[model samples]
Target: MSNVLPRAAALAAAALLATTGALVGATQSSALPMAPTCRVADLELAVGGPQRAGGAIDYPILFTNTTGHNCALRGYPGVSVTDARHRQIGTSAIRTGEPISTVLVAPDETVTAVMRTNSRSVAPNCRPKSTYVKVYPPNSGVAEEISYALRVCGMFEISPVEAAD
Candidate 1:
């Protein structure tokens, strides 16, 4: 009985150690991998608007490529809007696949992404939402890139529905 007890304890300890090792190995292997050699630098966001009916909100995002190696920005950079209470109210998927839309920024050049929101409605929720833009490396999901806020506000001002006739 005494020998059996020692053997059982040893087996349990070995099982525990093996389990722990597996867990650690899994965690280390499944980490959110580091970004590719490319990165976003000098990211800036500016919002302009409050124009009349059918006008547009000009949300120009500017950023520089500080890295020595050239990098390409693909598609329209993702833009997200947050309200006064810091709640994300809306998202603008404004990347049009226009020619020259996504291009490589050389070592020190600047890249600009212009996003336009059509002011076709004046719904309160869509009325001048305080917003910011975050740029991610091309094809990198929204989760990967750090966000940078715009200095200005986005006012999607449209005449009331009745006025649109």
Candidate 2:
């Protein structure tokens, strides 16, 4: 009976130490600062070229971080073709790429993604040119408007943001 009591006491002490260690670990992790997400106000977007290939026209969507601190971008930017009045003219861009991986942008750094639009042959009804391309950075509610000449039949796709090299 004496030996049994000591063994049980030891087991109880071990469990208490494990619980305390787990709590300390959780606390440390929670206290670490999380990276900030990129916002439209912190970015300057540029749309490059009509690199035509096959039945599609591709453009490089470049995002520059103009903020003073580092920020992260993940997934795809919300893209839409907008008319002069800023109303959506066609379907928003659908994401295309491998699973989302976070891309960190330092001050004055740039990141890029591809924006693809189908040719008129594929989307014959894609008439009524768009006057602006509205872009929303990933994980941000704010949007930036960029003036561009994009004709759409409601078909648009955007690849996930990645490090620009």
Candidate 3:
């Protein structure tokens, strides 16, 4: 009987320690901070310029977070060149370059994605003319329009979004 009591007490103590450790881990995990994702409504979008890069015309698309909170962005922004009547002038921008990881943008911070077009070199099959570029931020439905003199082939190549500064 004496031996049974000692063994049972040891088992109870071990179980208690295990339960305590699990609780501590759960508490720590729950305390970790999390930021919200950036939305189209919380951002201001602009096109920098039609800079010439080698054989392609590179347009630096800038996104500025206007909200006061930090937000996260990942992947590519949807881009399409549009005519004066808002008609799509070409195929939407396709993702290019290496895969990008999630980027956090603090309040008033900016991020950029380069849109490269070989409109001047594309075959005549690609009818390329546009008065504006419509941009959709990652994971957003609301699009922002940027007016710029852009000529693109029926296809667009877009680099992944990266930190501007």
lDDT of 3 by residue, 1-165 (tens): 879998998888778778764332356434333577789888889999788766667889998999989887887899988888998875788888668867778899999989987745653455556789999988788888888768775447888888885
Candidate models: Cα lDDT each: 0.45, 0.83, 0.80
- Residues 1-165, model 1: lDDT tens digits: 779998998888779778764333347434333233334432222333333435555444555567666665554455555555555555544445455334555566665555555544432234343544434544556422224343232442111001010
Residue pairs clashing in model 1 are 76-95
Q: Write candidate 2's Cα lDDT for 76-119 as tens digits.
A: 88898889999998578888765777888889999988888889
Count clashing residue pairs in model 1.
Answer: 1
Q: How does candidate 1 fare on TM-score?
A: 0.46
Clashing pairs in 3: none
Q: What are the TM-scores, per candidate, against the unseen true structure?
A: 0.46, 0.74, 0.73
lDDT of 3: 0.80
The lDDT, on a scale of 0 to 1, for candidate 1 is: 0.45
lDDT of 2 at 41: 82
- For candidate 2, give the lDDT: 0.83
Q: Considering TM-score, where higher is better, how would the candidates rank from best to worst?
A: 2, 3, 1
Give each prediction's root-mean-square deviation over alpha carbons.
15.3, 6.9, 7.4
